[model samples]
Target: MAGIRFSQLIDNFITTIERYGSTVLQPEISSSRPANIRVITSEQVTDCKIFLWTITPGGGGPGVRPESERRIQMTNISGMPLWPGVRTLLGGWSQEFGVYAFWDARRHTKFSFRSPSLQVDANTLETAGTTGIATQFRPTKEGEEVVVAVAPGSLLWYVQNGLPLHNSQDDAAFVVDLAAASPEEERNFLDSAQSEIESARRYDLVETMRAFRDASFRPAVLQAYSYKCAVCNCDLKLVDAAHIVPITHPTSTDEVTNGIALCRLHHGAYDNALLGVKSDCQIVINPNMTNRLHEIGLDSGLEEFKSRLPDVIRVPASIEARPTPDRLRLGLKLRGWPEEQIA
Candidate 1:
């Protein structure tokens, strides 16, 4: 715990799972001084739950070398629902293992949350424990879920788990926006979101919203695409935003459904093909692009992306939010070219 930090390990594990998509072929658990290890996965959030556990001595497994290291992993078995008193007790013992119970909303049960025991300032703990705790259990469907992310540094059990967690409201926050919220109510929402973020040490709500914005764009593009790449149908690390339009001009093709996000090298190679995502959201590779193949590392990826393009097309924004086909066309034509305005 003192050597490397548990949160660091957990964060690495989370990242691995996110990238590999559960059920890693085999993880390389290092036996370095800190007994470091890493497992990679490419799963999205909804793919699978990674349940980690230490091989316990009682289970005829290696015991944690009290002075050196401990083991923890993602799991499905949830710890008891923690109350303020419960959090305090657990917090004291958490250093040994950064642990908390994660509610797997999908299963309607705790997915198992654990951390290497992040020590909180007494003042901060007092505020965090009681402040964010909803007096009553809001229905699962209601807006009541905590997305916790550890700070990457500042003495964590592991450095990797340090990413900031942003808990987005499930519509209630926006509902308040729609309703005639009095100044008091508006102030409360902002203050509450702000307080939880500061005490928990997270980026502001705007940051969280930005993440959604980026993801929406990616999702929108892929919705019209196949799960695999549209060019080569290679579903590996090749499906990503190709920006039928460049990202240089955020106004033009940054939104979801605007451009397909291609993976690895296809994006860079796309411009050569005169491959344009029509303002109509159609894939339009110039007739000439048919010539360049292996030179761009897209012999397989490009072909795969082509046929699968229409399938993965993302849900475009509302008519009003969508970029006009003309701009999209102009944007692609000038992409990577001298930034010239459309005539």
Candidate 2:
């Protein structure tokens, strides 16, 4: 089958990102060799650039080009030819790309790019390298692998009929420094990337995202709560980040305000709907659970659990990090609390 146009792929890429609620400000496409897609999130351009390359199916899994073919030919800032002795001002350059493969009959899947260091060819006035993409900007320990979903898409009709032609000519390399991006900008990028991945409906990727999300969420919530359980103030290293709104809910979010740190016992109770937290941060026990405590063999422990809980759950000193009242209410409602009691 004939390959999709490079322009069409770019359009699809932009469309996919925008579908996740990110705005791609005027993308500046270069009119010369070494295609560029410049996404400007702010008025002032920064020094960070992220180069992206697309990997398509090959005889041996997804194939990456040789370093020589992937090199970025140097260009002046004005989009003019580089003259001798004219140096480029680009800094903090990193390369990333998506690896796409056919998952099943209907969909295509992509995985996160590996982190690779860029090698500058001074004599040739070009830059390129072959390395793995990091899942995030943070320094990962040596030999540790962090895999997350990059994006996935439904196969086009023509692509479903046969192997789509692989065209390296369509690859557009661009760069952005996520470490320097504002929180909102970072969230936008994550949201878009996650949306793309989820669309594939692959079980492994879904589970991976869930685990990754919780792994990332735990530290943020634990720090906000001083590494202690909000209900009982247990400071042992047994605390976990429990989502106020259950993860299965459509409206659930990973925001700190939507999470609370709790020890294993309280976390289990909260998830089971036997324990609830009001909008005012008051700890409440379900009367139905208490009435039937003996039947569940928790009659003796239930009283002790109630005694240990504070009048109000310990909250973060930062108001922004505190649990949102609306989310708390919704959480309680989801846990089968009566509307009157939830308020």
Candidate 3:
């Protein structure tokens, strides 16, 4: 699925409200239907039924402002009292509210509370169940008590350390940012994995949640490096969290220290054993890299890094989180680099 950001959601919400003139409906995270902004139009009665188009904007009648408009008409053909929830879902209530609601003309009063649509189409409702809210991607801890609010389908924000920050910001942008440190630091993969494993075991499930495992590890590694490639210091937001120790080894667990954020090119180089890190946290390109690249006419890509061989990497903040000296030695040993104590 395509990634959606908080800014885009807010912009879409504002645009929908402006275009429709009055009220529009959007899905909540728990909404049964897939998220969509539905415009409420003017009421019209045809034959024995009242037709209201929630899909098309400005087709039925003049849209009413959600913040102020109220005292709506149309009790349907039977003229019976409509459920308050229905009115809320339809964006009928006009009174100022943090949620959606509308007024009832026949009842001569504004209804209280917000309501999301409960439609159950296969592509919509079913699909929504299979996915998460667009803004909330990674897993979070329970009992952490972080205040979060979604502006219906349009936007999402969380209050962290007494400051509000939107998820729309680049993931790297949040790492090490003092204002968001508490929240970002809280996203530890080991903790998340343990939590998920416990949750799954509670249900007696045997299969390991590989997807969940990968999801937890990747973000933890990326955040630790503040989403920048530790080798090149590139902050292009295309970095990958690479494992220092191959998972085939028993000690290769998904710990923050066991991973490094690397760009695609460097990741490939490391995997191919063309690149190695020393116990002193220095990066070393293979001595034969220049000759090899020259033979293949691919020198431009890694020429700079090769020229600057034996450079220091951007070490993580925590000393323990830096690549393990043993792992670095092992990495070079596996690559047949003639270095026993260091790469």
Candidate 4:
């Protein structure tokens, strides 16, 4: 029985996301069998795991039966060590769905689906019934082989929606509908997702949601600003999607209206209160920094920043992507800038 190569699976995954206008960043293949791959989001934070298990015929259960009832057999792969960083079977929705573990029988470490009657002993881990985790993978028959073909839009939605622990088939269909939806309808869907994240009771879930939100937010801001720094217009590797109101603030949001594209230096400056953008889109440098310019070396950099001053910063052509006055005012307030200075 021949099996699919890990590389081919990755190529398929890449093709799926690219079709939906998303790029896979820093893909690291850690294993061949059971296909373990790690990816970084656009934010350059959070390691996402993409693990695939090939379901073979005639495995664990007595099945001279239907194709749908076939179980995925866990074969012992000796000397396989655990890979570092976060490992999730599908997307690490929750403990109830999947878990990170080391296979005692095979000495292999990876993410495994957790069934309701799952048993974990010192030597082996076994499941009593059909696990819900398999539904997300949604293995499909390709040629004569059964392989997991993850839905394209669902892959993107998983990163944006914090891997909601639910029926992935329905979620996949929902995302497909949204892809063809009107702008207002899409916005409403994103808003509803944000509301759910905000109302989440678990701290870990909130953090996961925020990380996922940033994954989408960074790219949106960069695109709105034409992938250039709004302050210095540096379009190189230095640009970063900076929050107008820092993420720690209670009222902070991941919306493009609450974000700005800036180079590393200006981003640091904006966060440190050394630079600011006003509601009228004017770029302002703090007087205190200007008062003692020579004291802080990097005079050339400071001059460059000053040269752009009294200047209206670049804004997104789309009204929705442009920074809102209320968010800018709140951000400035958080920076301790006086109202008179902003006015």
Candidate 5:
């Protein structure tokens, strides 16, 4: 038969669901690309089976290229569940039109999952297959139903049951505590995440997690330090949340105590081991930095930092939020500074 008319079909489908709930049925030609024959049993009553045909492109139909793009702006159809029958019938339609899917644990702590076709890696219906088969159905915050064809990047933190999905188990190899990942480490993570995406067929799950972490954690650090550079009190918006313990360390990376707000200058210095924090919270300029800056004739910036040495860093509002002395010592050690307490 001609391709399925998506608008009329979906409208009727939703109406049927609302008017009378749907029942699972077997497909006559089940293994086809788009299942040709299927059955729906509802209380409204119909003994004859429902036969669905291949979804075809309609002139001005919603799932067509232009119509689909515009429909993305409409929130009415967001978060619709794609049951087995619907998956067989409209899955190809959704893909042809760019409908995406994503799922998350009810809690924000665990990793999330997304439909594979959304990524740069793959896009064809043949590539995506079934949601479970395509993505291997990563564990959600338990009891959460799979949400199909959501707006691009929409996440489901809580399941339909209202329970928060939290995954406490950590995979040390893939999941690192990155307070603020170093440039190299960040690149490594991106590559690793990409590999995971391709291997597990999860398109943008890692990217989504990275975005969520930045949005929630960095602001907390900046606010904890009162939006000023913890080392030199630079108040510019250029201040950053620097991780005291390198993100590679096997500890919580996003905590305010593991972070210190620093301007771009100090952040770069700390990252490069040109600056170090003492056990007493004093900021020290690395001896190598002084020589290097003098050699490069870029010595003016040192006056501000050098004068601040022996003076303690600006502490956060809460004592518990202060960078731990052990982490500070770790920072000094990374800079090759003397371990003896500075006189």
Candidate 6:
């Protein structure tokens, strides 16, 4: 219960700023205990700070640097890691606030930092499920919190805090979302632990085709074969996520047609755009590079590769006309080739 209150207290402190509007100074812990324990348990907390600023900028402010056009200043600052919890708060509401330490009407600077303790609200103790510890990864109570690096899909910041310091300037960014810190933090942690795992998983079949030019050809081939790659025979390892689709293209998934089981070398050739597969499953070396077929000085370094493709075994009796064929054809067009070369 003491831990829960501690979490709740943090929420309330932020709320206090929203309601009455005051600079919040976290209490210094001469000594402390969990909210309900009522016993004094002493501890040490390394340095922790929270710098608040707007989410989306409005117009401009005075500065030697390029001022954000937002009515709010970039409040240029440095030395703060962007926190997810803080982002949630600003994204949710606090962003539009005209009340802040920078406002001329405010008496005290709206910023304060001190020791961090898990002392909950005296009444309703929070932070219950947490394990206490001050690991830079998590502000937990007792157990380990997995640490993770931000993913590419992850937004670095809606607005940044690495700005110049001034009474009116906003700077220093911190993790924004705290209420659900554990889950998100753990997600990041899992990513960190499984970085190699995800990378390996991404190397599955369809991507094998992507290594070649007109990357879509592999998918079209897979889709025609229902993702099985007739020549090499591969399938999605599990079902939750499927194998090859354009990284961000709208259409991609676990369908057999989307899978292609190219051998290791073929997969490499496809992704780097070194080789291209035809709509008819023929190999089309970049014409300008009289080198695709001669890399090893053997007129046949990769000549036998086409026959090794899954397409050789089945050739889709009726020739299903490779769905919407446009994407791959567009890719072909991107290479500036004429119909004769592709067909």
What are the candidates' C-alpha RMSDs? 14.7, 19.3, 17.3, 11.1, 19.6, 20.7
Candidate 1: worst 10 consecutive residues by lDDT?
85-94
Error of 6 at 317 (Å): 12
Residue pairs with backbone atoms closer than 3 Å in model 4 (clashes): none
Query: If ranked by lDDT, best first, what sequence of candidates would result?
Result: 4, 2, 5, 3, 1, 6
TM-score per candidate, chains pooled: 0.36, 0.45, 0.41, 0.54, 0.42, 0.27
lDDT of model number 3: 0.42
Between prediction 3 and prediction 5, the one with superior lDDT is 5
Candidate 4: tens digits of C-alpha lDDT, residues 1-343: 2434446655666565444334455445554543444343334333444543333333345555443333333333322344455433431111221222111211124324332111122111112112111122232321111112223333443433434322222233243243234445544555555345433423333343345456567768988988889988887556778999988786787789999998887888888788889888888877765665657664567776676654878898899899998888888888888677776
Best-fitting candidate, measured by TM-score? 4
Provide the global lDDT of candidate 2 against the true structure: 0.47
* Better lDDT candidate (3, 6): 3
Which of candidates 4 and 6 is the stronger one according to lDDT?
4
Task: Pick the winner on lDDT between candidates 2 and 4.
Answer: 4
lDDT of 5 at 255: 73
Judging by TM-score, tell me the better candidate of 3 and 4.
4
Candidate 1 global CA lDDT score: 0.37
Over 4 Å off in model 1, which ranges?
A: 1-27, 30-216, 261-265, 271-274, 279-324, 336-343
Q: Could you tell me the lDDT of residue 338 within candidate 4?
A: 66
lDDT of 2 by residue, 152-264 (tens): 22111112111111110111110113313344554454455445444332222333334434444556787899878998888655577899999888788778999998888
Error of 5 at 247 (Å): 0.9
Per-residue CA lDDT of model 3 for 136-217, tens digit only, reads 1222221111111222221111000111112112221222222222222333422343455443332221111222233346
Candidate 6 stretches with Cα past 4 Å from truth are: 1-138, 142-261, 272-275, 280-300, 306-323, 333-339
- lDDT, residue 180, candidate 4: 37
